[model samples]
Target chain A: MNIDLFFIPLQIQDELSLQNKTVIVVDVLRASTTIATALKNGARAIIPVASIENAVKYASTLEPGSFLLCGERGGKIIDGFDLGNSPFEYTEEKVMGKTLIYASTNGSVAITKTKYAKHSLVAGFINISEVVKFVSENSDDILILCSGKLNRFCIEDTVCGGMIAFLLTKGKSRKRLNLSDSTVSAIKLYKFYSKNLLKMLRESEHGRFLIELGFEEDLKVASSIDSIPILPIFSDGVIKALK
Target chain B: MNIDLFFIPLQIQDELSLQNKTVIVVDVLRASTTIATALKNGARAIIPVASIENAVKYASTLEPGSFLLCGERGGKIIDGFDLGNSPFEYTEEKVMGKTLIYASTNGSVAITKTKYAKHSLVAGFINISEVVKFVSENSDDILILCSGKLNRFCIEDTVCGGMIAFLLTKGKSRKRLNLSDSTVSAIKLYKFYSKNLLKMLRESEHGRFLIELGFEEDLKVASSIDSIPILPIFSDGVIKALK
Candidate 1:
């Protein structure tokens, strides 16, 4: 079956997930990865909000002690934010049994934008295997949407999208997989790039931007594929998963 | 030097170009490659217009007999267009001395957008080497703008953009060639996937879209690296050559 993939900037694609497809939203530079990792590390759940204002507003409705605010902008922790956007930052002690009221420059906003999707899942290198498995079993026309940085194409997200497409198309006929030109190219890119994921990550545009912002360590965690195993689904405007 | 690479969809990216830096806009499927190939094949100046309306209006000003209206949307020739977007259709006989009033789905619109740029050039695999040489010799921070299909991130364009970044940063220090995560990932993608540009083209979103529309031949033409050596630059809303 033909699958449609959209490698959209977070600002634009988040709104697209509601179009009634099985949407796999990828935000490789830690949002998707972090959420997956946080869930794996025993965090209770994650709440993705569109903005800091929403995070603040939502936090008020939840039990104050039950939730924690987390987000970043320009790759740094928003001033007064409880957490910044790094997989390493979402530690067991911090995220355990707490609802993360999350906002970020790209990923979180994109995730929330997918609230209306028939089936929405946060995907990253960390949980690629699980996400792919889920999609393969479900067998719907998939939309592997990339949460690009602020509505612009970011390389990391597309690579992850490509990787996912590669996994799905293996042992399959080209005719069986209906794909867009960009989708086919991304899968090819992932196949070409699978040999050196870490090197690829280290040299990416967002990678260097984060390094400059003193988050160089984040790349290592983001590049580790399938290290974390969790399915983060978006439903009812919140993201939670079954362990 | 820090280069900010923007991967915007053609819908909006056409409006954003480098006013200071040299801008190299890529539409690898055919437009950029076609323009370069046409110029090399001895077509007298290809005229790129953003819309079919403009193409028709421009032809009226010229002797109608000396010009041809050409372009496609959703991968077929527009109604009443003199020629489709396939390079095979643009033979020396059909295009020689004939000013092409060209308007394409994504590429020409992007070229039109770079009117305010310090320097703008159309790029595709066909003329990537020539475009890269031109940019490297100029040694300005280049915006390798991809003309994505309809304001969306098309994978073919990103890979093409990555190829540009890879060539630029090769044999250089990681520090000297400061890259965004997007840039680094693009380079890695090129390195991994450059093994088979033809295979890559055959499977892209735009490539398949073209093939479905009976322009599979155009993919071969677009994927031929440096096949055409002309550098088509955009200045004051017209494409000329820095060459």
Candidate 2:
């Protein structure tokens, strides 16, 4: 199996290059975790838009109350939006049976870019096992794409990406698995911080930013491994939980 | 001091942002090592150009015998160039007192992009201590920019960048040095690969390609710490050893 991991989505110059490859988009601080939570709590589907304007535009097309305008900018809820990026806000009571037009600073932009991928799955620590199981059973070429903060390297995303790459290649012969340099580095990072993921999150630059903004609890939710055991696959402009 | 490391120069969106900041360009596989070797062996100065056409165009502006056209395409010397990107080819007998118009695959492109930097220095394991000394004594806001292979992550550059970041913050209080995520990650990678740089190079994807192309000796020269022991600084479109 060939496994290539990009520390940031900017490394992917051509979106068409993702065609025929199974892509796992990771935004560990929130997006992946939030999406999985929304799906697990019964959101009908998620339409990941690149910008807030697009999210609002998409929301206008849907029947009122059938779809919710959701997302965040600068770690806070977008103006006049239904919900922010925190997973805790994506409760079953708030999201059940409704579609979410999501726009985030990093994750949604990354998820939308993978529209051409054969199997595009959103992943985070909370839903890693489910993502791994899906890809392991059905993938030969995998691209673990980290939705870095504004196209810059972020530790949480890269570490989550590393964790995914580590899990996928564990117990596999080194010669059989073609891991890229980024993959190797990610695995090394994952091993270094795997013991205390919450602490790693607490120390990351974005994590620090979030903490200052009163989202410390969000970090705890994001750090909980397998807490939301579901795979949210993005395809045809909507992300839905795989049955 | 604030230390930020970019895995690839592409992360630097605006050249103006590098203004007033010391930028260390690292391409450990060859370019950084080769440039430092050239300067240490008495090359007058290096004009790093982004492309072969630019190198050729710049050569036409220089006196015929005073400067040499040099660079590589795919690990091999460009057709009709004076030298390949190997430190061995930069003997005093060949490059003494002559300006080199260099246009390598990655390193030169990265160096040229830092034209707005307050202090832009080329770095490799060969001249790490010298480069570190210069930056430590003369810098505050430091950006260690790795010249990754074609804007994709390469272990050697990141590891070398990591080594620089690690050395810069070796004994400093964690609270004193403001390290970015990329800087922190580079430090970790450097710690992991510090013990066996040569072996790490041999196992690296770019290294394997060079070995297949018969440039294994170049890797050996590149991995040798402080072998060249010269700080090559880029300014006003030319790279010269800091006197």
Candidate 3:
């Protein structure tokens, strides 16, 4: 198996390269963690829009009561939207049986860019094993795409990507995969920060910004490894729980 | 002091942001290491041209016997150029008192991009302390620009940048500097790889490639931390040893 990691989606020169490959999109701070939580709470489907304008336009096409216009701009719930990006806002009572129209600063853009991928799965610290198992079982080439904050590198997303890479390569199948330089670097980073992930998140730039906005609890929710086991896969232009 | 780290020069959106700031350009695999070696061997100066066209045009204005046209493409010396990017070739006898018209795949382009910087210093594992001391004494915001191979992140350059950040912040001045997420990330990576610089260089992608070309000795030369105490600063379109 050939495995490569991109620090940010901007590094991708041609989206066509993702075609027929398993592309795992990671956004550890909130977008990915919230999406997984929303899916676990029974979200029917998620329509990820790349921009706020697109999110608003896409929501208009749906029957008003059937879907929720959900997203955040600068970590705050957009005015007139139904939800912010915090995982705490995605409780079972709120997201159950709802169609979430999602847009975020980084994660949504990365997800929509993967429309042509064979398998684009959402991942974070919340559902590590499920993603690892999904990729291990599939024989396709893999691309771990970290949805870094606004086309910049994020330590949290990278560490999470590295953790996945490390786990996948640690098994007996490790000898079969060819790891890229970025992939090796990610694995090294994961090893360095695995001791206390919550502290890492709380001290990160994005994490500190979220904390100043009074979302400290969200960091705790996002750092619980393997807490949510559902695999949220994007295919056919929509994200659905991989049942 | 405010410090930020860009894993690759591509992260820099506007070059003007580097103006009036101290920018440390790092290309550990060869360009930086080779340049340091040439300067240490008593080269009069290094004129870093961003492109092959620029290098040829600039060399035309110089006296024929005064300078050497140098650079590499695909790890081999460019056609009609005097030298490839190997540290060994830049010995005392060959380069002493001769100006080097330098260009390379990544490092030269990155160096030219810092034309507006207040102080643009080249760095590698070979001269970490001198670069650190320069930054520590200066009050300007620092930007460590890693000249990753072809705009893709190279582990070695980043690790070297991290070591600088680690040392700069590890001192009592740590509390005064506000590090961006990427800066903090680089510092952590530096700490992890600091234990075995030679092993890290030998295992990197560029390192392995150089070994295939029989430039294995170059990797050893690049990994010797503080081996070359000189600091090469780029200014006014020419690179010279900072007396």
Best by lDDT: 2
Predicted structure with the largest TM-score when compared to the true one: 2
Between candidates 2 and 3, name the one with more favorable lDDT: 2
Q: What is the lDDT of residue B151 in candidate 3?
A: 69
Q: In model 2, state the lDDT of residue B173.
A: 92
Q: Chain B alone, model 2: TM-score? A: 0.98
Chain A, candidate 3, TM-score of: 0.97
Error of 3 at B13 (Å): 0.9
User: How do these models rank on lDDT, best leading?
Assistant: 2, 3, 1
Q: Docking quality tier of candidate 1?
A: acceptable
Question: Among all windows of ten consecutive residues in candidate 3 chain A, which has the lowest summed lDDT?
Answer: A171-180
Q: Report, for every candidate in turn, its global Cα lDDT versus the true structure.
A: 0.78, 0.93, 0.90
TM agreement with the true structure for every prediction:
0.83, 0.99, 0.94
lDDT of 1: 0.78
What CA root-mean-square deviation does each model show from the true structure? 3.7, 1.0, 2.0
Question: Across residues A1-243, which tens digit of lDDT does each residue of candidate 1 receive?
Answer: 666666664334346545667888999887988888778777777888888898899888988788888989888888887888888888889888989888987888777667667799899898899898988887677888888876666777878898888888889887677876557657766776688887777766677788888887788888888888889998887788855
CAPRI-style grade of the A/B interface in model 2: high
**B164: Cα error in model 1, Å:** 4.3
lDDT of 2 by residue, A1-243 (tens): 999999888888999989999999999988998999999999999999999889878887889979899999999999999999999899999999999999999999999999999999999999999989998898559999999999889999999999999999899998899999899999999999999999999999999999999999999999999999998999999999999
Write candidate 3's Cα lDDT for B98-172 as tens digits: 999998999999999899999999999999899999899989999999998886788899899999988887755
Residue-level error in angstroms, candidate 2, position A218:
0.6
Instruction: Score candidate 3 by DockQ.
Output: 0.66
lDDT of 3 by residue, A1-243 (tens): 888898888887788978989999999988889999999998999999998899889888888788998999998999999998988888888888989999999999999989899999999999999999999998899999999998888889999999999998886565777888889889988998999999999888889999999999999988999999989999988999999
